[model samples]
Target: MFTGLSAFPLTPVSGNAGIDEKAYGRLVHRLATTSVDSIGALGSTGSYAYLTREERARVARLAVEHADGVPVIVGIGALRTRHVLEAAEDAQNAGAAGVLLAPVSYQPLTDDDVFGLFEEVSAHLSVPLVIYDNPGTTHFTFTDELYTRLAHLPNVASVKIPGVPADPEAARARIEHLRRLLPATVTIGVSGDATAAKGLNAGCDAWYSVIGGTFPEPALALTRAAQAGQPERAERDSQRLQPLWDLFAQHGGSLRVVAAAAAHLGLTTPRNLPLPLRGLGAKEHAQVAAVIEKLQLHA
Candidate 1:
């Protein structure tokens, strides 16, 4: 399958900050109409860490239901391997196409911990497995060696490597070498977007994206262009998305930024960030609104 934009949407929050199926379905519908190859719910973009088990499963079902045909990759990240295994089973029961796992949590883990974690989870699961790399928070990266190890695991289907823009060309070369470690059936992934096209062109099989959560059309268009070797066109669209990038850059790894984008397009209901991490304040929201308007996105 062609690796294209995979919009990892935020789970909607209702009036009391509960899971909002209505809002989530609406957002999913909008994305489903785009060229997104897949949809991910309860992933980092969906604030999976903040949700209860029931809420995560509910969002997983909602995402698949609304996607209609687009595969739903549910986020099954947790602090323990057993919990992740259980969540993966839950996602499978909930009809998710696959499971996306972020390595460990809270405390930093050694490379051996990562190997054992993936090995354990992959052993228990029947579905395709995806590795989520969010070094901005994990503070621990999947080293070339670590990834090499996980890539050999049976159920490992893909790797989601994000924020390597510092030297994307070099990252691509590195990923290409790493791809050698994985099975041929396994495809590599990047957190797709305009700026991400470089790595995609270099060798990504897919893009698991937060930006695609709101701008699937534009983002997918760019990814398609890049895949076709149309670097000039892809660069143009990536440049067009700079403002949105600026917003997330300011947040510095806050997954809440996905919700902010949803609000920007008026696709989500009145949503608030759960405890600990606050959403953009009043003035910030207004400024974000101004930028979204200038870009002429939905809403």
Candidate 2:
């Protein structure tokens, strides 16, 4: 079962040329060395939507290869169901442990549409399927009923919820309700590092972390505190990351912040982003650097 911090690494791009395989492999090595629960490539942070199917497959292959003994989960979401299925097949062939999927659509998708999409994709996959409920990106929210339905599907292993509510009480209550609704087999994973402490305290089984994917040590530290039921320690660790999270909020979020942070830490080359989306400016880079310095993060 997928549990603990599942790091989602960014896919390094060499301008418009294509994926920077060398840098991407370095990221996988870093995460594997940190011993994160798992590594997810081609996630939203990886900019899966911007890459071609072939590029994504290459990423999955490289991630699986460089991950050493670590399990790899590749994101296979696309607007078209056939494209998603093809990506799933590619991930499975690449020896990935599972595939993460979100119901990405140009038009608003109904519950039936989302359900049918997963049904079709799951029918074709032999590996585990993780339902990525990132409404912020997909613009398609899954109700409790729909999540429950998806949980019962064959090969459906877990679901990644966006995060808990900001309100502490509401967040706990929401997680409790979800626990009641979802089967024991379907692990409830939380995303969005901002509210991660609250989400984990509320009983989330795993953390699908963005920042952890970029720099797993601190995030892994926070996850250990949370898992140990040390709320005060977890909150302190989360607060320590607030400055960096603040930069993410001010800028374009994890996609941009992670790229900037990775560059600042010398993990990859600067300006390694796809077209239509550029790297952070000098001022923004300064902000991320300041936060990293303040946090005392050593790569």
Candidate 3:
């Protein structure tokens, strides 16, 4: 479940309405039909932080149901350890193959605090747990020492690190260093879609992707190429999507651009993000459409 492309699908919610289960199921089913190794139901890209517990549980169940036989890894992050435990229980009940936990908090969390959270959660989880080190959203940076500590916890299967360095050798060195620190039982997955190919080439075990949630084909193509030791093909496939990566940088991050792309493809309703968040405007949508067309992403 931790290896290859773990596609994190958006949890589409219309304005002043509940989750669009039909649309969400469509996204999960689409991924299951593809070569994605796992379905990441409610990661950062899925807007798990914004939904209620009931809503999140429903989304987890939906993801598992729609995923066919593909493994489903559900995000179970919350502000409090109690709530995180509750979310973990809900995900387990929903038959999630694994749970992804990010240390989310309003107040800054110390390494001990973060480790305690994982320790408590890991003790309770029957399935594997992926340590989500998404500092971009959680605002808690994890050190190699912290990773070593957390990796020692039982049921902790993988660590989703941030992007690797742009330079190839530097990226490989970074990954190699982490590999030595982490137990062989624990895998190191890479986030940051733009650098996924490089990370894989650097020997990272998986791509915890944002764009893969919406466009599995290209992401899977890159993943398969990399895993097959065809680094040149993987890099070329990644370079081909540079325009979309630029769009992610132009916008705040991947969440908005991917939502816009999904809407453009008619895979989900326009403005499908949760309340207090809005989709791209007309001009930006036009740009997304152009990029999708040019890349032949929908073909």
Number of the top-ranking candidate, with lDDT as the measure: 3
Where is model 3 more than 4 Å wrong at Cα? none
lDDT of 3: 0.95
Clashing pairs in 3: none
Model 2 vs truth, CA RMSD: 1.0
Better of 1 and 2 by TM-score: 2
Displacement of residue 16 (Cα, Å) in model 2 is 0.6
lDDT of each: 0.76, 0.90, 0.95
- Candidate 2 Cα outliers beyond 4 Å, as residue runs: none
lDDT of 3 by residue, 5-119 (tens): 9999999999768999999999999999996999999999999999999999999999999999899999999999999999999999999999999999999999999999999
* Backbone N/Cα/C clashes per model: 0, 0, 0
lDDT of 1 at 128: 84
Comparing candidate 1 with candidate 2, which one achieves the higher lDDT? Answer: 2
Off by over 4 Å in 1: 14-16, 165-172, 192-194
Residue-level lDDT tens digits of model 1 in 57-160: 78887887888788888889888887787788889998888888887578879999888888898898878888888776567787777877888898788888
TM-score of every prediction relative to native: 0.92, 0.98, 0.99
